[model samples]
Target: MLLLSACGGSSGNAGGSGGSSDDVLSLALENTLPGWDWRKQISAGHVGLEWRPVYDTLLRTRTDGTVVPNAAEKYSYNEDKTVLTLKMRAGMKFTDGAPVDARAAKFSLEGFRDGGGADSLRLAGVKVHVVDDLTLTLTLPAPNPALISYLGGSCGQLVSPASLDSPTLATKPIGSGPYVLNTRATVTGSKFVFNRNPDYWNPDDFPYDKVEFLVMADETAQLNALSTGQIDGAEISLGSIERAKSTGLRVDSFPNVWSGLFFLDRAGTKIPALGDVRVRKAINMVFDRSAIAEGIWNGNGVANSQTYGPISPAFQKDLVDHYPYDIKAAQRLMKEAGYADGFSITLPEVDHYNDEYSAIAVQQLAKLNIRAEVVSVPRQESISRILGGEFPMFVYKMPVNPEAEQVSNVLGPKGAFNPYHSEDPELNKLLAKWTVADGDQAAKVYQEINRFLVEKAWFAPFGNPDLPWAFNGSTTISGTLGTTPPLYAFK
Candidate 1:
């Protein structure tokens, strides 16, 4: 659950410290935003999430986990769970004064359905029907109980019809959000200023008037800037949590619903060492999750074996005790796998977690007779290379929905996560049950799948680190932070 700080009122406005008449709020991050075009890419760094301030979804999720209407004033469902109707607020317009009527909503959704160059493959199957100037209908091919959660996702955000028609709008998005993009600067560093949208639709709900984002790709530079007060807040680095807290800055951290690999092994790969399931389990047994959580994250991480959490009532808690660090048992397994001689394996650069943490893994795994070769690369190139099958083992952080159906996106056919080529008829069978089963059955099925992943040694489930952030004592931003922080409420 999210713990809202009853700290005094935000410095001033939703944009920055309230007392300051200057509407320009400066923010800083540790990396350059991948792109400004929300509809053109997925995982475009924090800025794309920042775009939530520019784009509006049909519904909004509050820090309390309640859903509220945003662009749409109301939405209803039919008895059969096939048709969903959304009603938009009348007289709404984008920042450029372009009417954000039902027609524009229809066009934007249709464009996404027809591949609007946006990275929205999850919504590829949705069929939309505009009922009238005030109502929009979504007709699903089959009954989907989790559709509401999907609608509340970042990819479901609405775009302007004029922007959809104009190809150059990617460079300058015109949104119905509370803040409008002011200047997009990219010289020595990347920066953008957001001015208050005076004609914003929800004045009572949105509090801030302006906000600024500065991209600082270098970790050292981001830390320096935060200490010098050049920026208000930043995502906490692994080794800097204690330092941040000691400075009187608020350090907020929580266990995210995310999982990463300590190691991965694909069957029939060149590295015969990884082909042995016992060897993989041996490595998992030797992994020191507690040390990583304490030494690296400064006690701001959660020890997890699999991905699901209590947030999803369906999460299986039995799996929590599946793996524990036992060097003796690991060595026994290593000997049983005919690797008493210890073989060499490449520990490629993983871009998902703190680079220093991955380095720590390489050092720790060496004690158990598994000789590791470490290689580092840029984050983008590293992701592309790993997904393209460049290395045998790698690490990645996956942001997943808290539902069994959406969880299939990773383990399903052609899914990005089946990197080890793990396939089972029974596993596929359970995924198909998502359409017909309710929460109880879905939980059982996902539990079965979790057991399968563990037994097969498909991937070692390590700790799910709590996402930590350090904000200036004077500035405040609203949103619940998890694996992937919801950015819609970030004013």
Candidate 2:
């Protein structure tokens, strides 16, 4: 899920090669939150650590956006384009050594579908079919070109039967992934010790002996520890990139699949300002995304033009380019919408997005004669309020997905994330066509969708930012060419 799959086709035999248990590795991260359950919601911060030794999937996209096989050894598409048959590798076992057969994969797929959670919408139209122990097929209600791509998303990560052995796999998970969870309790808010699986299917290439994840909120605290050698690497805040570089540490910045915005509550009736489409467009034009990307972000980020989509090639074509910065256009739209004198709206800020970005957004809105009230709150409280439809327009972050299906799930009018209730009939028609086209044809359709979103000013894209970091001298960092994906494999 971290941009690409590091997995390869099976060489021959499957299972562990008997490595020493002393080879434990440790990693450090800046923040943490309560949603560790992969089945519940979409949170990138959790997936960075939680994904390592916990979940497995059928295919993975590398930093270059190339798909690679993970759990499935061989796969084939049917003539009708409705069934996806995958042949599982033999001799593979879970952490508990329970047989990771086709049935287990089928159960994981079916469990997610019937879970009836927000994530269920991603799998709603698909049906799982078990052909045999080594082979399984995914049957879609219609011809879905995004099926294989969906298999590479966070939602497609395979879960083990042992994960269900306990009632709370959210915190204490048991998986067959490359790493295994070694800690049982939270240090600050869920800390884990990740040891390279001796039984991991591919042990030769996974260089890290062990990995550790500490979930703390303060980015400055993370940087402070990295300076003192308490942590090796951390995500630097937008304002701290140059300072991190000044310390002679290695800085890695990439365009992450994360975007922040003020989501208007479409279901709410009280806030009349949000009902107007021009108001949203005005909001998009107000913020100088380029300035935010250059000054505050230290050239580490990009201005995102489209709100509810991924930055990857899989979904990028469906995204509209840059948002118009002309304040006159914004003013015209506002006046035509009958808010010529400007109006005030309150926005509750969620901490997951950059705080500076939210404050700047409020200032930008003021330029368009629109007053925005900023209310800072904890991440969980903000999410609860937003989900309950309390705020008219509130700050939120949408994590990037490398697949197009994830986009459909978030942006499609009737899809799960219909928060704005964007009922663009043309977009709906294109999405339907996109869901069933071949890879090449899908890309073309997405290109049209992208142009449409841009023309409508659906969501502004701030440029992708660089993610800075410092690592041990032994670490080797390389960037894949002509792509904006974020994935790294330690050698």
Measured by TM-score, the strongest candidate is 2
Q: Given candidate 1, what's the lDDT at residue 336?
A: 94
lDDT of 2 by residue, 47-138 (tens): 34345455666665455445666677666777877787877878878787787778888877777777754556667768888888888888
- The model with the greatest lDDT is 1
Task: Let me know the TM-score candidate 2 reaches against the reference structure.
Answer: 0.82
Candidate 1 TM-score, true structure as reference? 0.81
Q: By summed lDDT, which 10 consecutive residues of candidate 1 come out lowest?
A: 1-10
The clash numbers for all candidates, in the given order, read 5, 37
TM-score of each: 0.81, 0.82
Candidate 1, 205-295: lDDT as tens digits: 5445666667766656666666777776667665677777676667666554454563434463766877888888887787676776676
